[model samples]
Target: MTDTFVALSDPTRRLLLDRLSEQGGLTLSELSEDLPMTRQAVAKHLAVLESAELVASERDGRCKRHYLNPMPLAKMAKRWLVRFEDVPLGSLSGFHAAPAIRPAHHP
Candidate 1:
């Protein structure tokens, strides 16, 4: 879980995940294109994501293709984020709406 958070902490890793989400099965070279960083830098980011189980890669002949594995993120959301959806924000004191006031008119 910590690994997942750590992997998500970096903007570059998040961008890599977004790219993979948009199009799965992309090679390191394909993922590196259009980015300011070098291929090796992207690979390092991918490595962190892979360690968190957020990215999965498979070798295709001579090249390795990377894909997004959303399970870890889903699991994290289910564990923490889902609970927020169940409880309405209005029910929470901090989120509760203040009473509307009416202006008094002078005769």
Candidate 2:
């Protein structure tokens, strides 16, 4: 869980995840293209994501293609968000209690 958070803490890693999400099973070269970082740097970020189990890779002939594994994120979100599900919708909405009334004074 901590690893997942840590991996997501870096913007580069999050971008990589977004790329994978948009188009799964992408090679490192495919991912690195148009990104500010180099191919090696992208690979390093992918490694962290892989360690956190947020991404998975499969051998594609000569290269490995990376894919987003959303299960861990889904599980974490469920754990964190499920507790709030029971709360009243009105509380979450813009339904604040009324303020106390005060008498208007003439200037």
Candidate 3:
């Protein structure tokens, strides 16, 4: 989705998604802790991610928790890299295994 790519294009937003992937989910305050920005700023970033459908939120008691939605990401990758299925360009598993983009698998 265009929104998904637009949201992931930002480093801060990427960091937010990384945090969610690492921690499963986090509150707005929790997500802001190690970042240089204030919680409000992080919340703004979260808003963008949410709008992009890269993240979703729900209330856990008094706090609002945010979590990553990986499906859209996979869809984007498929749309961008799938090519012609009949052509056999191989799969993402093999593609991501390449040395050039392999480091992306590291934390």
Candidate 4:
């Protein structure tokens, strides 16, 4: 979805998602520990990701644990990338029906 793409466009958000993917179910504090931004900034980015449905959170006693929701990403990839998957790489390279060539000898 467009929202997902937009959310994924930000490097901070992308890093957050990567962190979630590497270790799912992390709290805001946990996610903010190693980041250059403040916890509030991280939370704002997480909010964007949440709005895009790329991340989900559940209350864990005193805090909420955010986890990566990969369904939307998977759907996007399948919709946009799968079509090109069937096309051969050679065709994309404009080498259709071309034979490999060796370098000519120089005088």
By lDDT, the best candidate is 4
RMSD values, in order shown: 4.6, 5.0, 10.0, 4.3
Off by over 4 Å in 2: 86-107
Compute the lDDT of residue 5 as modeled in candidate 1. Answer: 99
The runs of at least 3 residues in candidate 3 whose Cα sits more than 4 Å from the true structure, single-residue gaps closed, are 84-107
Write down the TM-score for model 1: 0.83
Q: Number of clashes in model 4?
A: 0
Model 4 C-alpha lDDT per residue in residues 24-92, reported as the tens digit of each score? 999999999988989999999999999999999999899999999999999999999998988977767
Please provide, for model 1 over 2-69, each residue's C-alpha lDDT reduced to its tens digit, 9 standing for 90 to 100: 99999999999999999999999999999999999999999999999999999999999999999999
Clashes of 3: 0
Highest TM-score scorer: 1
Off by over 4 Å in 1: 93-107
Candidate 3 lDDT over residue span 54-73, tens digit each: 99999889889899999899
State which candidate, 1 or 2, has the greater TM-score.
1
